[model samples]
Target: MSILAEEQIERFFNVLNQSSEIIQKSKDQSYLDSLIEVLDTVQSGDVQALNLAKADTTAVSDIYATFNRDDYDSEVLRKAIQMAVLKAIKVDKIQANYQITPDTIANVVGYLIAGIFNGHRQLSLLDPAMGTGNLLTAVANQLSNSIGVKLSVSGIENDDAMFELAASSFELQHIHAELFHEDTIQNVLAPMVDVALSDLPVGYYPIDANTKGYNTRSTTGHSYVHHLMIEFAMNHVNKGGFGFFLVPSQIFKTSEAKQLLKWMQGHVYLQGLLNLPTELFSNKASQKAIMILQNTGGGAKQAKQIMLGEFPSFKDQTAFQKFLTEIDDWQRNDLLQ
Candidate 1:
């Protein structure tokens, strides 16, 4: 990032922090709640945020004035909000699943999406497990930049705080996305989209009754939420459309893999599984891989050679570039054809 961009993000973060602190103190709300209110205040210039906080109008106005939405691009705004969200996560001791997806991972997902849908003039995207809207906005911003394509974005989030944060983030970024604040595993209605992306929440889904009819749902006990979400996401993807998920590196080795594989056999085509650099995680259990899948029909078929490999450490520029080149070659020679 350029020095100016870094300075701009810091400036915006400072404003967010100041406003959040004022609100948190007055309303006794959590940092995340206050931050959402601050973002809303900045986006709509509404006095409701001020009145709710019972904060002095002049002080709050001065803090918010330092931020000019026009001054920063969507990516910059995203990064600034990401920084603030990270702080709020720490302050609130949010759960592991609520953590924001890293920028590096989001960038990789964007690259894969661009490659899959290259030359398309327009696209629709869905994120069934969107948290804070960071990954969704990041990928959308990248697609707009890389392909100059018009985009329709949609996301689903069950958490109240995350839903509000995502809604505010999208509005602030000028991204007109359809957002659903409901449990994805439930009967949430959404349009079939051209592409879907998710950093799947890892754990067991508590509701056993909702597991009925899902091919990947376990016969006993709670079903793996990640597996259920993958099925749910793929169901909403238009035939031949792609879905990219950040899944546990050992996803296929899990006990539930048999059911997941069974579902894959009848529905989507597994196109690729690219393991992110191990160095990115603290241990093997925590590592994630990007799994690419394509819905059946619409002429979609399995590639002659599946794209599979471990990315080199990001610090190793030469190896990383070579891996990306290999991905490009695979897409051109096998997948796209």
Candidate 2:
């Protein structure tokens, strides 16, 4: 019932295009601010839209000013606002620190989450580096499409621009989420969940030498920043919860990373690994892998052999569709049995 018709979707894009034309003529204001202001006005349904329109600061008013509100579809406008933020981030007008996941990869991740927990009526999902909320948003959308309600999402993002964009987008889409705008490692997260998903940031954050979880060998010798983020996320999972992380492939080859992996194996079930394409990200040239883990609750019998696979170029629609089908079949058989 919440799905939009094809015509409505087209109209939304048309509205976005017309709004862009208007913003292009206004030199003093930015599309981001105007779009955000319009979204705020739509969600709040107050006089801010008119106030921004009346202010003689630019050639045009706020994005909602020109629209005839009597017949305007608020849903379309909300979606346009959400898409505009993602578009801005995509064009590099916003600094994402080159951490955003590709749309296709995000879809694959979403599909895996949906399939793995197909029978679950409620889920809690977390993303440690949730840039613009795309990955979680994608998974939420997938789940809603399958079961007609969104998941409970808690995410952490250190970047201010990304945090605002993600928060606004989640609000616009009516997705249930609690987002933390701080460094994930420095911040304490106590909520346990059914799923954890992240595309970890590639750099290091300064750690206190005396901190408990700190390992000087891993931190100084080889930048185990991803390791720390993974551990933090892992701690916030329920007994049978699962985690999926997009990490550098070095975790499988380096000695420090091997130590981290061994430690994780002792605590949780190391389910499998999916090696992603080297060219999946446009901004960074690094080989990436998807590490899949399940919380074993420290049971000795819970450890199992890990299944390994490689994802074909996710950009190829046919291959992705096939991969999704295979995952669905596997999840159905494995999970049901």
Candidate 3:
């Protein structure tokens, strides 16, 4: 089933690639009219006659030629249609600044975190930096597949394009998800979550006067927004909640980050820090680490120790699988003297 689904998705992408030229050439109104017709047909459940937007005769023929491939399963086609809507936002020039989490890593993170829950059927999960909702989808997929129950998923995305794409993707997956289009630092949500996950953007954000009081670490100083986002995710986790953040490993080496890391240790039980492969991202300079934060909440309690693990590379499937299998045991280890 999975193989057939993958093939169909590949073929659908081919059609989109072929239609790229026509879409770029068509007049604005003509493109809109053509798109409306295609949408209307599909919404009416007419899959057999799925057609590309009415462009030039040559463009239409090119799309049909690409679509008429070796058909193995009709099931894949329906899934492809829904995915097409989300994949349409991949205009590289427009979205170059965005760093999308790869599907494999996202799923791995989601599955590992979901595995931590023993009997929790109803879960509240949050992703403050959810881009196109990939992280949310991955985590939710793992949770639902494991416990046979839907999750109350919430996400915040500041990018307008990402916000719309994520909303459509959630609808297609039939996930009961709430997404917001607001800066995470500015507008805070009211609900606390059981789990929080984010692949935060790498940059420094100037602390605005109004939002300067959000974190106690610094009032008016410029801080790594990535660190602030991680703090934001940690703060939103309910007492005893779990959070997973993908950040640069340099957070452990820098003087400023050491203070924040010390502060984090004082608050949450730092479960694990696994160094990801440097080449995992398009930006090879990004040395990433996955910090698993288990919020014990405030008061006199302090974490006994934090588990530290390093992976030279994630490309080794066998070694990576072994790493994942031992996570539960890794979390139970006492690193404090």
Listed per candidate, the RMSD to the true structure in angstroms reads 1.3, 4.5, 5.7
By TM-score, highest first, what's the ranking?
1, 2, 3
For candidate 2, write residues 1-337 as lDDT tens digits.
2455445545554555445445444434556554544444444445434343444324233433544434434344444555666565554376546355665677667777777776777889888888767777767777777765447889898876667767876776777688898877774564788889988876555564423464322634344667777888887888878889988766767666655766676567777677787666554347777887888763323323454677777667798678767666656555324
lDDT of each: 0.91, 0.65, 0.64
Kindly list the per-residue Cα lDDT of model 3 for residues 20-86, writing each as its tens digit.
3354455333332333233333223342343335545445464555454245233344345334443
lDDT order, best first, reads 1, 2, 3
Return whichever of 2 and 3 wins on lDDT: 2
Estimate the lDDT of model 2.
0.65
Measured on C-alpha atoms, candidate 1 has an lDDT of: 0.91
TM-score to true structure, per model: 0.97, 0.78, 0.76
Off by over 4 Å in 2: 1-38, 45-83, 90-99, 148-150, 208-211, 214-222, 278-285, 298-305, 314-319, 332-337
Candidate 1 — which residues are off by over 4 angstroms?
Answer: 52-55
